[model samples]
Target: MWVPAKFRSKVLAEPVRRPQLIEHSSDKNKNKNLETRPQQHPILSAQQHSISQELHGKKPAVFKMPVDYSKWDALELSDDSDVEVHPNVDKRSFIRAKQNQIHQQRFERKNKIETYKYERVVNDGLLKRINALLAALESHSADADKRSPDELMFMAIMETAGDSPNEAPPPPPAGVHTQEKEQPTYSKMMAALVDQVKAKVDEDKPENRFAAYVEDVKSHKAKVEDLQRQLLEELDSLEKEEGRKITSENIHTGFDSSHVTKGKAEDKSTGEAKKSTQKAQTVEVLNPQALGKPLLTKKSDGQQSSGADADADEPMGGDDDDEDEVEASELGKKFASIKAGDYRTCLEFISQHPEVVAEKETDGLLVLAFNSAIDGAYELARQCVHQALLLQYCRALGRDGVRMFFKRITTPGHQAQKVFFDDVNSTFARIKSRAKEIEKQRAQEEAEGTGGVEQIQLHAVDPNTTINIQIPPENSSDPAEIKAKELFNAFPPGLQRALESGSLDEVNKVLGKMSVEEAEEIVAQLSEGGMLSVEEQIIDATTEEGQKALKEFEEQEKAAQQEQAAEQAALSKYSDDPE
Candidate 1:
């Protein structure tokens, strides 16, 4: 058998020993035979003497340590005899398949990494261009009209040239083919983008469109950064997996694997320590008073009541020596100490202390809290909870508070404020629609004689005032009384009181609660009943009925003016005749 070059040295290093057979003869004859055997050569006799001394004397032979061949096990040499393949399959094809699989995996990983890098580069360039354009616009806002569009585009290109020094030029127009296009020192793409922005400003004139463009670029940059971060994480995972495979192979290949194992263990421990530290830091940051106490308290009937409800149930202007006075004072102080624009902190404080929401003032604070909750940027489920809590607070504050909230949010400010206000406005409109639906359902129930004796709290004209009326069950024997009661209930409690008091201011205040159609219907009903006197009705020209009413009013005013003039002329003629 032919020995591999790697094992040839080991095979030749050890000599084979053969057992020698001794002839059975008399001792004298054996000595005579040895003497006659031959006069051995001088060097051979010396070597025999040394060997005999090594075997029989106290001298010992040198011991050699065995050579380890385990390191070679990791080597995927083509001459390896231990690799087994299917008897029916070709070995070359099997190896080729494995190579192709490895290549494909590597190609995919590289392509993904390259894609993320490309996206990151593109987003970074876009962000830089937007920042440049925004800076230029803001710096020259006063002289923006004085500066030409071409000059602005040039300035934008110059500002971004340093970052993307080797930016590629724009592709040639269709139908024009060239081997090599002229490379410009500045980016053509950035110039084109600037032109597009200028065109948008001229065409649509969106309020500060460049600033919005900057925000969009930043958002895209953030997405690209996230993708890059994920890509790096995947690369790190791949490196770790490769290291583990190498370490596993090293174990069988007689290589030192202790260092890799130790490093991995140390890294794991460090990660665990970091997690524990982060958890402790997070716990330290949270307020125990805010987090430990539940927002809703369980009632005796197993129903839960929110803090706003509980506060509402308490009598106003209570004694200063109340047991909860100190806590309430502390909460108020905390709320006051919160910085403006810190909506999240304000929201948390309001949630923990619902009494703040029930106060007559603090409409601005409640609006900010509602904005923070329903801003549509946070988690959906958490946002829903926040919205529900704020809506409950709105209910606790009543119609006046809601109106104040709407007015405060509607005041012109940042674009984000407008968006938040619109969302809130839509939310309130939906709530009002829902209330109408409920009212319709209740009316139907009353008509069917299934009305219950429920106590309904109606918000009055005054912000501080609320009227709690008990809805009587439909048990009246007189049909007229029932009809009167139904009519009385048809009008809002505030409107009913306003009509009875005959106060225009009170009527206007109650009318604010009704929609335009409902207010018109109520006004017409009052006029028909002779409860309200109308000299002239103001009409909105935007509506067809209002337009027709306005035309008739104008015609009537013109005819009256002509009649007054004729009377003046007739009086003058009588005075001239001296009658």
Candidate 2:
């Protein structure tokens, strides 16, 4: 067969033959003969081998395939590549700029992660410290004599810090060590950090940032506790869900066929009894009167029987009665506990039994506790007011209850009680005076058909009017009046006009729209200006003049009682005479 040119060399080739022996000759002649012989090409030799294979009917020799290493040649080293840069820029500077940009990106990422971690650590430490201080305060453990000076200092700092963010700590308490004294390493580190931050921010040197931080933490305590409670509730719900899943899985997969067989057998044995028991239970649930009645069954003798069942039911009734009696006794004991003037115990009791604040039956006990707290030692009384929980108790007492409580303490009994009553009474007087003034203005406006609206005049004051109407001042020539004038001038023109209208209702409307602190400040100024005064003041019995006044008051009371008795006796005599 004729093969294509591509395969011609392999398909048609000369066959290998044995070399013939040469005759003996001189060395020069042999070398000349060897040189003169023609050389066979490689392609011709390969074709000769293939032809020999075809002729011999033997398989052609297989050659191993060569591996291409050109793919590896495409890879270029990063450093060896030439970079394109602007003609004006040096290659080294361009390379350095690229390196710096990459470095800056990595550095910023590292710094962000590090800062987050640091803040997390700081917040965790702060939370721990706040919880510790709150627990100490709540449990009254900080007052213990055995506590260290550092503990006392820490408590004082946290307690005495003002609500304002820029407020400083009060002076160190007696028996407490100064900041320079030895403290925990953590506290020292925090102090150092606070100092560094203050310095960097150019804050005042006298400000105590650490104390302010503590105060801020304390202010958000309720929110933190609420979050913790929510987290705990969520965790509990998740656990319950998991438990339900496990229970359902077990119900579906854990039981064996033998258990079903046992259940069926038991049902067969107790089916009639179960049906009768269910019927009785249904009757008891449907009929309210049937509650607590023993289930009676008809005996073979045709008589209904419930001998042991009735006996078994008696103890349940007795248990309920006993529980009611025990609860009543416990409530009575709590009420009686406040009669002793122990404010601490009273506060503890109120905390444990908050129902005292809400229950009408405990109103008397609540008042008694408050009176006892006021009558107790000065420090204890102050501490009672400072207790955060006490504010809730006071609010629960309502306005009337609070007024009565203050009235009871207003009596010249204890010096501390009187002092507290005076301060509270003054504030109450200011609020009441403002309320009364607003009411009076509203009444006048209603009478005049103005619908409680004070008409404002936009025109300027007339200087040439025939009637030289002098504006009567609220107070004249008194020191309080001078102070009031100064405060009035300081007010904005609109507010001054409202105040000048002499309709306190308008002033109240304006104040109502203001911030609470500003309103309070205005009210305080009004009070200091003698515009709000207590309608009544109790005489101080500790003074000599008060003692004489008391005797005169007693004589007057005796004379009035005698007159009242004489009138009653005369009326009784007339009635006895049937006239």
Candidate 3:
């Protein structure tokens, strides 16, 4: 019914069924017209129904006319929010509200970041998780694309082509396979094509070109050989450079060897005088060079400090430590206030009197700063407890305790706690940075395959390069004797070598030194080999072997007894017959 004008005549030619025909009459009785055009008439509909039934073998399809487009509805309601909007509200006001909310959120986020301590470590963990999450997200995103409408349609198209391969075959050339199945049959054209192909094939005969091919192959081989030599030279130079870097990095220097010498000299000089009184308590304190050593000393419990005692410690002080009694008293009171967690008051006091924070205490920490940590001067400590008063104070608060103090620090009121925290955190930060640098260096060495080792394992060495594999020069003539001497020196003679000298205590000690894996391996070997063999012998004696031996002995005795009886019977028969 919807056929194009050009196709209408062809469709109308097929008339397989009969339908009621209409007779049209024209004016004046003359033949009007046979030409047909589109008509919304009953006869035309009937003709269309007959054509469908005859051509397609189905009932005529009823086509619906398209509704009118581009027609506007005057009374239609508008859905836009701006039209007939609220009297008081406007777009600008709404935008301002949204902007205010965004600013509030941004402010909150900034405050959160500033307040959260250990943010760096937390961020590192988040970054690691994000990296793994991104990898998974990317894979899922690709899956989503594949499942989308377009990709699914593409897949359907590919599946519809039966026996389709991963890659589509190239289309034949224009002349080749150009004939359609619906095209008119052409026997003469087919014959002409076959004859033409035959003539073309005969005119051009194949020729041998192996000599030219061989020359080309030889040239390529020469180029490849030159490239391989260049690669080898590059590898050698890179290896040499890497070896030098590794050697330089591994070289260690700057050990405080003088400290040991100084300690020995001090011990010799103090051996006599210090013996009379109570021995002083030695405590570890970090020096200016960042060396951890036992340098701090505390007086005995019974000792009473006098003017001379203060004078003894005065030599250790510097020009900055020239504080008179009145100044020391005033500064001490201020330091005590700071120790009491009154940071606001202490900060003001230090501004007027700076020497309170500047002078170094005997504990090696800043005077007021050490008091703040030990005396529980912040919001962190639930209880105030002093572990020690003198040199042992720093010692008892070991490295771990010191770190815990740093972690438990609360609000840094004003500048006092801030300055103190910076001092402590600075030391740990340096160590952490150095550790990261070492880790990066090690990763680089592994990637470049360049690091120092006591020995190198060579799977395959270059024939051109000379390498010395021997570690220690061959010094001994008899290798067996040397190996035996080594084993003897490594471990003392036990039950295996000298059973007489072996003691149970000594053997137990050696066994104690054996690693768990080594012990298990030894036990496993014994159970599988020697222990199993011994157990099998015992089991055989209990079940089969002993029984077999006893059976054989009994069989021999029975055979002897039967032989005797046979001989006696034969003699008796001869005696009775008397022949």
With candidate 2 superimposed using the best TM-score fit, by how many Å does residue 520's alpha carbon deviate from the native? 99
**Candidate 1 lDDT, 377-416, residue by residue in tens:** 2233223323434445456657466545444544668564
lDDT of 2: 0.46
Candidate that scores best on lDDT? 1
lDDT of each: 0.50, 0.46, 0.37
**Candidate 3 on 1-579: residue-level lDDT in tens?**
499999899888976544433555644345344224222235457766556554654455555798864433322222223444356878666666665774565455434333232233333333333333233333344354346422432342233333222222233333333454332222232234334433443455324222222233344335445555565565455444434322223457867455321223444465445544323323232222111111111123222121112123222211112332212233343344345444345345444443333333222233333334334342212111111121123234553553343334334475634654464456434434554566688779889989532221121132222222111123566665454333232222221222123343433333343333333443343233222121112223466876785576568779889999999999888796755
For 1-579, candidate 2 gives per-residue lDDT tens digits of 777998888766856553343545667665666545433334458667655555555555556799998755534232332788889998887777776775565455444444434334444554555565555444544354466434544564355333224222233333333434543444544345434433543454335444443444465555545655565565555444434322212345555565321223443456567656655544222222222322222123222122222222321111111111112223433445353345556555554554545444333333333433434433333332233223343456674565454445445586646655455445334434554565677678889898632222221132111111112365678775676666554444445556667565666655654444445565566555545433333556899987886786688779889999999999888885754
**What residue runs in model 3 are displaced by over 4 Å at the alpha carbon?**
1-482, 493-509, 513-579
Sorted on TM-score, best first, the list reads 1, 2, 3
Provide the lDDT at 164 for model 2.
Answer: 22
Better of 2 and 3 by lDDT: 2
Q: In model 2, where do residues sit more than 4 Å from their true spots?
A: 1-83, 86-89, 107-116, 140-579
Give all candidate RMSDs, comma-separated: 34.7, 41.4, 43.4
TM-scores, one per candidate: 0.22, 0.16, 0.14
Q: Model 3, clash count?
A: 0
